[model samples]
Target: MLTNGLEKRTLSDVDVRDAFFDELYRLAVEDRNVIFMTADMGAFSLERFKRDFPKQYFNVGVAEQNMVSVAAGLALAGKKVFIYSIVPFVTLRCLEQIKIDLCGMNLPVTVVGIGAGVMYGGDGPTHHALHDIAVMRALPGMTIYNPSDALLTQASVRLAYEQAGPVYIRLEKGCLPVLYEDAGGGFQQGFTQLRAGKDISIMATGLMVHHAVTAKDILSRVGLSVGIFDIYRLKPLNEQALLEVMIHSPRVVSLEENSRIGGLGTALSELCADAGCRVPLMRMAWPDGHCREACGREEIHRHYRMDARSVAERILDWVRNT
Candidate 1:
């Protein structure tokens, strides 16, 4: 079993899933009303969850729709419900239930989707979650959290429990090097500036935040002053804070693993247009298409010019032109 002592270990080896479930199991122990529902996507930590909280845990087979409905029912019955499944299955397949049963009623149900973006890699388009943010964001009253590392993931789980309405926490599959020691007040503020610079600001979510940080280092070597912002909260975006940051930098680049349309890029663009912020913006994301088979996350990112080197080059080009 994972322990709180994990906080003392090297943060670079932390996995978001482990940190999330560890905190979840702790919460369940503290709150009898907490319940966990899964649509047949099993995890190593879940085995212990089932063994310890058998009465509160349910595996609804592969029925994503039923899983969501059941979670909504449990919430209405006074349970702090958490639903888990693969991203496309939980969000896209059960979008109707999520819309009507959860968001429509404004219940406190946390839907945790694993494998955000192309983390499914070889699983192809069916497993990719490029459109999850776009589709889910359209649903009214759904708060979205796309954490970049274990620290933020654990914090988001706690926030999910505290929130009253429907929340969607998107997570990438497998282990990832840690991005932050503490997301600090950033989780509450919706965004945090990881590195400060005057040339441009790179706003990124999920795995892209790590890439953007690396790109910042690369640009720094060439005397380019670039800033990095890690955005964990998508909806209910901190427009005032974002505007404050962007106002200092003349240019802003949004980097995300999802599609360029309707994800972070689109959200930020709309924020700029509506707020009438005059900062020139650029977005780096996957083109509207399916990732070919035999491609891993890095391969796909490289192909789309979203890798650190490529992103740095793109920023340089944009800076030169603009």
Candidate 2:
């Protein structure tokens, strides 16, 4: 039961990338066995890593597949390895390496992919990782996390470092809206309910968490009580929490920045069926396709009908009809 009353802070306010590197530096300092690998993209942050811990840093120079394989090999030798790169290049380009070398072998490698979803909005379709979730979720024994803000991002990085297994962490490009102030020291690797309501449940992830929060406010102004769930861990979802929320609300709306297929909606639907819960489910996400050109994040969201206004309208329509 997390409440959202803290002042909204942008990603820049928290130095998310620095926090990630700071944790890595701390871990590497303590554990001489830890190693960091990158596909030549972490120039600014990796500099400190290279200077402070030169022996533990490896720059793979654009070869994401080779980087992942090397990290897998290192992890197999009891070395805590982390692979960093942009979202598309890291996830899609190295899909085979990730699936075979890391996930298939059950290696404890932390694969950090920046610019998840449309975070690289103006960078065009080539850079947008619209299908990264679908791809990463298909891998077995892989832990997937999409942190809502800098705080959660730092927490996820720390957890990935501590946990043993192949982990995929999707990070937004820059600063995002801070939705949670104190997750009570830290949040667990599962969904956290941000707001509680009996009429509707809004299950959201990634950047959409902010939108869900905004939508909740808008819906509430209209005398609608909406429950909000921040789905931190995509795989190994908090089934019990989800079931309880759905059972209590009777109407669930899943919001995500990725496609409807194989994303939050798919997971929630499966959870409902598995729990034998009957509810009217609505999915708010990108359509079952790709975009043509580059656009701003807000424009893309509105074009796809995933903006706060659109979500609010959808929920209002559903409530009225019901």
Clashes of 1: 0
Candidate 2 C-alpha lDDT tens digits along 1-322:
3122222344346655665676678778889888998898874556778998888998889899899998988998899998989988989898999999998888889888887677777777887877888788888988899988776777777788877789998876455666666646567748888888888889999888888989989998999988889998998787887787788887899998887788878888988888888899998777777765578878878877788888899889988987
Highest TM-score model number: 1
Q: Write down the lDDT that model 1 would get.
A: 0.88
**Candidate 1 wrongly placed segments (more than 4 Å):** 1-5
TM-score of 2: 0.92
- Candidate 1 per-residue C-alpha lDDT over 123-180 given as tens digits, one digit per residue, 9 for 90 to 100: 8899999999999999999999999887788888888999999999998656677766
> Which 10-residue window of candidate 1 scores lowest in summed lDDT?
1-10
At residue 202, give the lDDT of candidate 2: 90
Query: Per-prediction count of colliding residue pairs?
Result: 0, 1
Model 2, position 260: C-alpha lDDT score: 79
Instruction: For residue 101, give model 1's deviation from the true position in Å.
Output: 0.8
